[model samples]
Target: MTADTSMTTVKVTTEARDRLAVLAAEKGQSIGAFISGVAERLPTAAELDERDERTRQALKKFGIALAISERAEGEALWAALDAGDDEALLKDPDA
Candidate 1:
């Protein structure tokens, strides 16, 4: 079978299993579906690193080329954007 069609088993403690069952019941999802959802929403180290790089690129594009180590300015910009200010990164990228 191809990797896409392969299946694997994971052994968990009874408590953990019961917890998963409860969560699945609450969501109206089968254990398989619930597990899949959990796995899909999780980000790997590589994904986070890539997102950081993308953030840097986006900042640079907007003329806010602060180093990655300097997260204060970027966090503020993100906060403004989160607060519904679309011009946060657009108005003064140099700021």
Candidate 2:
């Protein structure tokens, strides 16, 4: 009976449905509208923090860690590149 607007259906547990209904009522909007608005809005800092925690947990489960290191000569190389001193580039044309 409602108009279709390229929307998709998702199934949630009874508890989740109840919680969403309560949140929507608090915002004076339907559950569908509340979910749509959240999808369109930018994520908040709290949301980003939660996302980062979830990512860290998932990476830990897979025994993965991201790390960065610099070589001893990295600063000189970067300085040369910044100064546009192409002598090094000429010496190592292949590089």
Candidate 3:
């Protein structure tokens, strides 16, 4: 081992060994160089983003869900507006 670098021998599974060999060949890099490059440029686990999304989920089991809001049903006013009854709208504020 030198001050610049130290080599440590380690064991890997047959599948891992084969995959490393293929990757090294494809990238035109020796096995040692490929492994070293991977180790040097590897992204941090904290930097990796994981998204969890669910469709048509039921959150009832977890806890009670509060109602967002209750909108006033201004059905009559909407109906008058749809009919274009300007006179009726002015006559009755509710309508």
Candidate 4:
């Protein structure tokens, strides 16, 4: 790697500076090095898109499972209510 002698100035809020200082100290790094490390490790747009898609798929699967469970419970409740079985109506069908 070539020597990185370039310099740039960044403006940040006092609170942000304090937080970065604490984090840099914890990692035994200078504030500039800590910030540079973070910039280098940031996820690409494609990686973020893939993560979002996976999350959406997982949520969709969960929603389908929840819908199926609700339908089963509703059917069980209606059946017990129609039969006038109070004990059965209060019981969990999946238990």
Tens-digit lDDT string for candidate 4 (1-95): 23687989899999999999999999999999999889878978787667666765787877833443564577678888889887886686668
| Candidate 2 lDDT by residue in tens digits, 1-95 | 24558877999999999999999999999999988877768677788667667776788789975322222244466778789976754554225
| RMSD to truth, every model | 7.5, 17.9, 21.8, 14.9
Residue pairs with backbone atoms closer than 3 Å in model 2 (clashes): none
lDDT of 3 at 3: 50
In angstroms, the error of model 2 at 63 is 37
The models' CA-based lDDT, in order, is 0.82, 0.72, 0.61, 0.79
**What is the overall TM-score of model 3 with all chains considered together?**
0.42
My TM-score estimates for the predictions, one after another, are 0.60, 0.40, 0.42, 0.46
Q: What ranking emerges by TM-score with the best candidate at the front? A: 1, 4, 3, 2
Deviation in Å, model 1, residue 34 alpha carbon: 1.0
Query: Which of candidates 3 and 4 is the stronger one according to TM-score?
Result: 4
lDDT of model 1 at residue 86? 91
Model 2 stretches with alpha carbons more than 4 Å out:
1-4, 44-95
Instruction: For model 3, give the RMSD to the true fold.
Output: 21.8
Q: What's the alpha carbon RMSD for model 1?
A: 7.5
Cα lDDT of candidate 2 equals: 0.72
Instruction: Sort the predicted structures by lDDT, highest score first.
Output: 1, 4, 2, 3
